[model samples]
Target: MAECLAIRSALSSALDLGIQFLSLKTDCQVLAKAISSKRTVVEVHGVISDIFFCISQLKGFTCSFILRAANVEVDTLAKAALASYLVIF
Candidate 1:
């Protein structure tokens, strides 16, 4: 929840500054299910406490679901960032 809240806050800040029509892609099927339906189950609470917060922040954009393979570049960049953070510490 804390992690998701931080991301939601960051997204809110971006939107407040006029970010619009951005392309957001995700690879998590469960996440896709939640966003597409605008509803979640009890298990979703554990997975996405801040998802609704982020959804409210985006008023003019769309999010897409992509296969993890199709998101390899983003995956690699994220992995690199994680590795770099580890190395830095």
Candidate 2:
């Protein structure tokens, strides 16, 4: 559920930036598959719907899953950012 919200947030940011073409890579396979298939489980249905709506506004987009090992850098960066936010708060 958090992963879906994260993807939605990223997509929303890209859209806000007027990005026409975007490729989203996620380490969460289930969320990736849900986005690709357009069939989401109950807990994420609303966010998935929002994501599909966002995708419709884009000229081109691709969502895929990567191995967590390959996503370490991004994970580290996100964690660091969150930690900084916590410290600031």
Candidate 3:
């Protein structure tokens, strides 16, 4: 569920930036497969539709799954962002 939301947020940001092409990677296999195969599970059906709508607006898009170990940098950045957000509050 979090992965689906993150993907939606990322896509929204990219579209806002007028990005026409994108290659998105997710460490969550289910989310990755959902987007790649254009099939939605019951858990993320609504979000998947939103994601597909965003994809239609782009000239090119690809979503793939990466091993969590290979996604260390993203995890680190997310943790740092969360820490900063907590401090702000």
Candidate 4:
């Protein structure tokens, strides 16, 4: 759910910035697969719906999964945000 919200928020920001192309990378394989398939399990259907809606606004977009080790920067930021009880963009 957090992954979906992050992706949706990022996409919304990109759209607001008039970005026509985007390549989103994440460490969550399940989320990546769900986004690529344009479907989600019932548990997160609402969030995925929002994600897909944001995706549809993009001219070009790609979502990919990277190993957690390769995403250390984001992981660190996420941990920091959690520690601070705040949300990271």
Best by lDDT: 3
Task: List the candidates ranked by TM-score, beginning with the highest.
Answer: 4, 3, 2, 1
lDDT at residue 39 of model 3 (Cα atoms): 87
Each candidate's TM vs. the true structure?
Answer: 0.57, 0.78, 0.79, 0.80
lDDT of 2 by residue, 1-89 (tens): 55666667778999999998989888888888888887767877887889999999999998899998999886666566556556777
lDDT of each: 0.59, 0.80, 0.82, 0.78
Q: For candidate 1, what is the lDDT? A: 0.59
The prediction achieving the highest TM-score against the true structure is: 4
Across residues 1-89, which tens digit of lDDT does each residue of candidate 3 receive?
55666677778999999999999987888888888998888987897899999999999998889998999887566566556556777
| Residue 22 in candidate 3, Cα distance off native in Å | 0.5
Off by over 4 Å in 4: 78-89
- Against the correct fold, how does model 3 do in TM-score? 0.79
Better of 2 and 4 by lDDT: 2
Worst 10 residues of 1 by lDDT: 1-10
Tens digits of per-residue lDDT for model 4 on 1-89? 55565666667788999998999889989888888888776877987888888888888989899999999887666455445445433
